[model samples]
Target: MRRGAGIGAIRNREMVQAKYKEKGAEMAETQMATLSRQLAQLRTSLESFAAKHGTKIKNDPEFRGQFQAMCSSIGVDPIAYSRGCWSEALGLGEFYYHLGVRIIEVCMTNQKRTGGILPLNELVAQLNATKSSYASEISTDDVQRSIKKLRCLGTGFMLIHLAGGRTLVQSVPGEMSMDKTSVLGLAETHSGQTTMSLCCQEFGWSEDRARTALNQLVQEGMSWVDDADPTGERVYWFPSLFQAVRSSG
Candidate 1:
């Protein structure tokens, strides 16, 4: 009788465990269903929003940047698959893809002068000046979006943030040394040009140390030497910084 009781207790325990497992599975399924519904609702709302502001988002750089930010917040890539629900709704995918192509052309065209690194605004300006059918509508945001797509082509397009709120689009594959980067930052702070004396005064570096870093940048074609300074001091002008100055002027 004791043996039979023990067997019955084991059966009861197994039954309870099986029931709990089944309940957990059902709960998981229900949660998944709720999440799916939420996602569907989000997509529908996003599509409606995109459709409503499609033109403004496409033609205006500021508006487009804001829209991209919104899409990013929701984990939506409007241009992810070229042509899909989001693209069909907003027509942004085709716009950015074409812009991406034009960006490659511009980068290749100016590679000699800029060494695959140029001011983001200047790049946009050149792209708009290309007289391409969509050139008139191109903006900095558009250029940035297109460059994001160009990463797939292994083109090494990247955005660099320099001092003084300057941005550059880099299409080359190279790492800037710390000293070079610091020099660029210093130049950015000084209207895109840095004199050895300024560097020495600011960083307390010896004349030789300051000259070596600035000279390295000039050697890499990343900076231009300006011996025409009224102060009779050679100044290193970072091209991207110069580009920013020109645009602002």
Candidate 2:
């Protein structure tokens, strides 16, 4: 009715929009400042907690786990601090560094047999065996955390999740083809032995495809050829599973 919107009205609307944008920016800045203060407080609190319980954190795995969880909840990484107060209070930097070294040593020591793919349980057992009886026991959580930190080295220190709730650590950096990994799954489920026929039947793959996958793994030294089968077919056994299969048998 008032000649639709006049130029003056449009100018007024623009001014209102500009004001809202300014306010929004101010509010965002305020929120960010508040968050920064909160984070500082959280870090201070964690530091105090660590300083008070430094001994327990060093000697008690459970206490250390709880402390770590608290730090993780706030996006804090004690291990990253590597030096200064946090490291001194938590002992995280030195402890995990040493643990990471031990883990890699174990993996390297058994690399020939495992092809750098070792089961998590075996790794833990060998590691603890190397530790003094007076030393605190290392848990899987500890190994996993240490490995996570070791990933920066780019050596492919990663945990592989496979079928049947089995976790394997891949210490050597290598590519795992889909077909080969699938065949490994079959091996894991069948007492660590998978043959050409089994792979073909399980994955509905062609004979050539199955053979290629099995052969690839064998070439990688991850699989051993068991040619003594009564059926005359070569059984590809996973070295990582030999101990388990043998113990079970």
For TM-score, the strongest prediction is 2
How many clashes does each candidate structure show, in the order listed?
A: 0, 0
What does candidate 2's lDDT look like per residue over 143-229, in tens digits?
Answer: 888998888878679887776777788888777777876776778888878899988888899999998888877887888998999
What residue pairs are clashing in model 1? Answer: none
Superposed on all Cα atoms, model 1 deviates from the true structure by an RMSD in Å of 4.9
When summed lDDT is taken over every stretch of 10 residues in candidate 1, the lowest stretch is 81-90
Candidate 1: list runs displaced more than 4 Å. Answer: 1-32, 51-56, 60-63, 82-84, 131-136, 195-197, 204-216, 225-234, 243-249
TM-score of model number 1:
0.70
- How many residue pairs in model 1 have overlapping backbones? 0
Error of 1 at 4 (Å): 21
lDDT tens string, model 1, 5-112? 999999999999999999999999999999989987987787887878777776777888888887787688787745444666667777777788778788778766
TM-score of each: 0.70, 0.90
